[model samples]
Target: MLTLIELVGIFFFAVSGSLMAARRGFDMLGSAFLGGVTGLGGGVVRDLILNQSPATFAHPVYFLPPVLAALCVYAFTPAVQKLHRLVQIFDAAGLGLFCMTGTMKALENDVNPVTAVLLGVITGVGGGMLRDVISNVTPDLFNPRDVYALPAILGATATAFAWHFDVLNIAVGTGIAGLTFVLRLASIRFGWSVPLAAGHWHRQPNIPNHGDGPRRNF
Candidate 1:
């Protein structure tokens, strides 16, 4: 289930990246390159942290899907535009699924709870981060107003906790994945975010007199 979800996510992200590349008037090779990176970048990072070769490199079929997705997007731009909401839904689903999968994989490798959560967050956000870096934009996850990375953190943490408590058997893991999926989708629909102080600042205290020489104060 997790593998299938990741594949679905990869296809949509690849298509989205390819469309963006097309908008930039890139040639076929450029489009394929962008699509492939957007699709597989997260998995590659997860594998490297786990001290293993990337699954995409070992299984060449991993490359085919993204390339094909790019071609389809290039050939059917208008149709894709018409289904933009559907694409967003797929992307959200993929995000949740990948977070869960990364957490599970980390646990299987005997990673501690904190490391599992970190890996899960990395797996969830790494591809999009790479995509934004390639596109020369600041990542949306870093924006205080965006709801991207929070959902992944919430999902990953939940999975780690479940594993730690031995509450996530195969059936329970599926449920946890479902829970993460719902949380992410709700965040999308509701524009959820961590509360922040808007237009507020705290003044720093001055340091006491040190000596005859002038001193710097924090």
Candidate 2:
């Protein structure tokens, strides 16, 4: 079940990446590359930080989902275009699952709970960050448009709490993921946003505020 969750999460992340690629008028190769990066980048970073082989490299089967996602987007462009608005939802789901997987892996490695939570949030958002960077867009992780990291933080905290209580089973993990997913979607649905920096730091007279420009989807 955990393996299945990871695959599904990877697929969700791949969908977001491929969809973004398609939106940017990228070709098949671009779509495939971005999809694979979004699907496996986070876990690879987590593994590397933990001084282990990336799971995607060790289990080549994990490559299938991202490839499949790219193909789907390539072949079904029109359908995908219509559902593009759901990209955030797809990302949210992946964020939830990845956080759980990361936290569990960290705990398995006997990391302290705080480190586990930090790693969990990193695993949740790292792939998306890489995707945005590669695509030359601002990462959603830093976007002030919505409550992004909060959900992952909450989810990771929940997972750590569960682990502390020795009840970190499949059901609890799934529930925590679901909670994160719902929180993310709800934030989007309600146009929820976190407070931006509050100081009246003055920009240079000639310096333009990019924040006032059109908001680009990451």
Candidate 3:
């Protein structure tokens, strides 16, 4: 069940990644590259910080969903276009799932609760950060105009707290994930936003941060 949950998270992120790549007018190579980066980038960073081998290096299956998602988008542009509308949900799902999984893993590895929560947030959002950076655009993460990291941090905090208190399990994690997911989608539906500093605060109207994922354009 754990492995399946992780794979579901990977697949959701892959869909968002590939959909973003297609919308970017990228070719197959670009689609695949971005897809993979978005799919596993967070876990890669998490593993690195934990001083463990990247699961991507040992589990090639992790790469499959991104490539497959890219191919599907490339071959079925119109159909994929329809699917793109759900990209926000996909991103939210991935963010929530990874936050849960990352926190659990960190706790299992003996990381302290506070630091584990931080790692969980990083593991959940790092891929989207990499994706935007590679695309040569500022990510919503740094954009104070966005509200992504909040849900992730909340979920991670919940997960870490549960673990430290000996109550962390699939149920707790799932609830936290759901909390993150709902909050993110609500932010999108309700135009929830955080204020940025003056002069440095410019909203990137083109791409709203769908919670640690790419927008329709960048």
Candidate 4:
């Protein structure tokens, strides 16, 4: 079940990545690269933190699905564009599944609850972050106006808490995943955002390049 869910999530994320790449006028190779990174980057980070081989490297299918998804997206651009809403729906599903799966893997590795929850959020958002970075865009999660990380955090927390209560077995885990999906979708629909003060901003303590002038924007 876990493997199946992971594959489904990878496929959808790959499709979304492909779409984004196409929208940006990337070549086929660039689209494929984006798809692969969006599908596997998060899993790679999760595995590394857990001191395990990255799943995409360990499992051949894990690597192929994203490539295949990119090819399909390229071949069916019109169809994919027409089904943008469906793509978003699947993306939300992938986010929820990845969060739960990451949490479960952390638990299997005997990680503490806090670490597991954090890992779950990382696994859910890391791929998209990689995608954005590669595309030279600010990651959506870093944009306080975006609803990228909150759903994953909430879902991971619920999973960890439920496990502690011995309530989130397989069925309950699925429920939590579903709830996370719904919450993410609703956030998109409602434009939910983290609270931020209009005049309050935090500045970095250290500057990476002294030759560069002081940063003006917060």
Question: Candidate 3 residues 1-218, lDDT tens each?
Answer: 65677777877787777777877777889989888898799998999999999978998878888888788777766655565456677789999998888888888899988889999999889888887787676785787556888889999999888877888777877899899999978887887777666444454455456698655544
Top of the candidates by lDDT: 2
* Candidate 4 structure quality by residue, lDDT tens digits, 104-139: 889878999999999999998888888778878778
Please report, in order, the local distance difference test score of every candidate based on alpha carbons. 0.75, 0.87, 0.81, 0.83
Model 4 Cα shift for residue 62 (angstroms): 0.6
- Between prediction 1 and prediction 3, the one with superior TM-score is 3
Lowest lDDT 10-residue stretch of candidate 1: 79-88
Candidate 4 steric clashes: 0
Model 3 residue 212 distance off true place after TM-score fit, in angstroms: 44
Per-prediction TM-score, please?
0.76, 0.87, 0.82, 0.83
Q: How accurate is candidate 1 locally (lDDT)?
A: 0.75
Name the lDDT of candidate 4: 0.83
Pairs with backbone N, CA or C atoms under 3 Å apart (clashes), candidate 3: none
> For model 3, what is the alpha-carbon lDDT of residue 90?
79
1-218 per-residue lDDT for model 1 (tens digits): 65665677678667756765665567888888987887788889999999999888897878886889778977777653544454445455656767888898889899988999999888878877776678776665776656788778888898898888888776776676677667766876877777565433554457677687877656
Q: Residue 72's C-alpha lDDT in candidate 3?
A: 74
- Candidate 2 stretches with Cα past 4 Å from truth are 79-83, 200-218
Taking every candidate in turn, the Cα RMSD to the unseen true structure, in Å, is 6.3, 5.8, 9.0, 5.6
Clashes of 1: 0
Output the better candidate (2/3) by lDDT.
2
